[model samples]
Target: MRKDIHDYDLSRHNTFGIHATCRRYIEFSDEADLIGILASLTEADHPLFVVGGGSNILLTADYPGTVLHSAIRGIEPMPYPTSADDILVRVGSGEVWDDFVATAVSHGWYGAENLSFIPGEIGASAVQNIGAYGVEAKDIIYKVEAVEIATGSCITIPAANIGYAYRYSRFKDEWRGRYVVTHVTYRLHRRFTPHTAYGNIAAELQRLGIATPTAAQLRDVIISIRRDKLPDPAVEGNAGSFFMNPIISRAQYESLLATWPVMPHYDVDADRVKIPAGWLIEQCGWKGKSLGKAGVHSRQALVLVNRGGATGADIIHLSDTIRADVRTRFDIDIHPEVNIL
Candidate 1:
């Protein structure tokens, strides 16, 4: 249930296709194995990093510490539902995220359909608070089960205490290196309530002649839209949505709007507005452009690609160039969504 290797090749671990290695690599398939491995660790494993699916990270150099990955996998529906309208399902951290969405949709479960096709794993979903369309993982997450890395004690934390925010969770910040997520429980609705108002979902449905879409149809529409915009990591090396959309004050947004007159924006609240980072990048003339081996994806300017043999540094360079330009032109700073390590 556990495999430990020294001086491990990590090229296949990350989606970026960056050639890198680590001091050690450990994969555990169950909670007991994880506890045993943690108990046996020495100072050699000083700085440990946990990765899942490796879809949202950019490895900048060879890691000098141990890399932990979860191989534990399963999906189980909890018996004795407390609510007739909803059901709770527990999913292993190592399970592919999209696969879980697919299963949920196939079984007539709602809530997760809006997040269909987003990459990464269930564990990463809880950590990243992954969202797409209009729904975030926090909206459906009932609880998170994890093991404290220091004490190897299993603990279940409810969603309310996780401090969920926009593309963020306590796990990514103050709780970093404190625990490794093993499973996530989600509350799904039995009655299908499709959220098609956000983005182009409704428009796409209308174009396809679907007035009332089933969960499967909605998922298909989202997948089609994503495929049209984002490049496959398998075919081209890239982290999806390299930048997080910048949220600015309403006054700032209004001032910028006066000059551009047609700038796209989303109202975050009464005081703030979310500006699309892709639109800003494209306006700065980085879309479909290249800096060495790293380039901006033509369709989705938010994505930075490894054109062929791009290194992590090459991607960083390209990102830096775009960030600088965006700052100079708009007086706004855009940050990367992908973790750089």
Candidate 2:
């Protein structure tokens, strides 16, 4: 219920350590408080911004309007006439994404096991359809609830309407800045199937010496693998993976395969093939290459890290150079996974 200016430097707040400022910033704790704040806003005068864990973002300049820091936090079972085995968890937008995954796995929830250690929040996950290891967020989402910024009306948008794809959702483009996600409802089953077919998941399970691995084992193994693969934001400062794996036509992939012969790829569609951006980046020799405190991660080529005191402009410049180089060399455009603001 108070509106006052505070030290709003977004450097420490955002995962990238980009020094940027917001004009007005406010944090709220619950749904009612969010609703109350929304009711106070004048529709045309206030341009709204909602920030979650500040993981997958880069701020180029100071905002000229209100920045609403989403803090609606909790996890509760959805009320309904349903079977006991069927569970629906409502998570606050501010809930740490990876922590939520850990909780679900510990509770024997099956859906989020492959998506361990991803950054950002529960609500932002749906908007971006965050994916890793073998799973995507939309795979288990039941529904997403949001408060309309313009009118302060609450809505339960079904998961199908989200238009999920590889690192994308309708929310990223069409519904951008349209809603402040209050909570997300996910249906995780008590007795469920497991996903262990992708990447090193099977190998990790074997290394753990389990014929039949429990959900906890899978979670632990995945966390271990990602810990080794990705640089921690606490030390090096990163926004996880920097680029989306580019999907090209099968003919196009075959052309590259004909040249490289050992080119690895996965089927994205009937004609489209998805290639690892890391492989492409490493081919370009950008991994561990530094330019003015911003560089590709030495350990993982897919991740762009702030080695020290890099500004937003510095990171983007590095990214632009990478993208342009990749496009020129391979004739394949590399798109950034992180959203630039």
Candidate 3:
């Protein structure tokens, strides 16, 4: 296996920029290559894990298992079998997620504009159900194709078959180590319908003096918003939005709202309300503060950054401290959106 590299350095692979290595690292260019690697691994009885752009993960320690990565990259326009106003596009797993969004916007395609500037690849996009500005990947994903690692069998699963929720799918849980995503089919609208209701998108659009904006314009606004808030991984060594927003019952939200009148919240449903994790973290006085090499990002309290030379343990310690403080203060549990491995 010429593609298999031993004692592979993964310090540059993950966005957290943590120093870690794997026993073996294999890069597969296509399904045939993936099948070959899977077959070999299956016979060898070696533990394995699949990785994408490495944007949404925190490497806590050197992996003891073989790390399989996809090199499959391409975007193809599929036949639009549905209405005339909708189109289908199949994207390879290794394609950069933001690049695909940019392509869609450039072509005047809707639905992905609000997802602009999100990190990671197309495979993780569908798997993680990555979202921003009120738009989630599940909303646009039509079908997903993956290769079973144990059997080397390829299967195409429709969107309906995939259980999608806030920042999660079966790929993150039950099917986590079982399948390696090969491609994702996205159904996008040909007609533009801007979604600027969430966050400060509407106000930003107004501030920019833009009305009836195009997809590209909307993407630009999103990029600007992200740049203004989130820290760049290249410079800061972080996975954006380290914690998922905590969803509480409406009764719980009401109880907290009585104490803090201005606490921001979003209605998840009649039963639940979503509270910003950043606010909770900031309230705990962890914002822009550091514990050794690990620090809470100043601009976005939700992000945990490596000041420099921060090990995985340092981050975990800092995160634990923040979580404990939030629980003590708000009686809420905020969990990491970034996968800690």
- TM-score of each model, paired residue for residue: 0.98, 0.94, 0.98
What alpha-carbon RMSD in Å does predicted model 1 have with respect to the real structure?
1.1
Q: What is the C-alpha RMSD of each candidate to the true structure, in Å?
A: 1.1, 1.9, 1.3
- Candidate 2 lDDT by residue in tens digits, 259-278: 78888787877999999999
Which of candidates 1 and 2 reaches a greater lDDT? 1
Once fitted onto the true fold, the runs of candidate 2 whose alpha carbons sit more than 4 angstroms away are 1-7, 42-45, 79-85
Off by over 4 Å in 1: 79-81
Supply every candidate's count of residue pairs whose N, Cα or C atoms clash at under 3 angstroms. 0, 0, 0
Q: Model 1, 1-341: lDDT tens per residue?
A: 47789999988888888999999999999899889988988997879999999999999999999999998899898742578889888999999999999999999878999998898999999999998887999999999999999999999999999999888999999999999999999999889989998889999999999999999999999999999999999889988989998999999999998787888888889999989999999999999999989999999999999888889999999999999999999999999999899
lDDT of 1: 0.92
Q: Give lDDT tens digits, candidate 3, residues 128-174.
A: 99998898999999999999877889999999889999998998889
- Deviation from native of the Cα of residue 10 in model 2, angstroms: 1.3
Q: How does each model score on lDDT?
A: 0.92, 0.84, 0.90
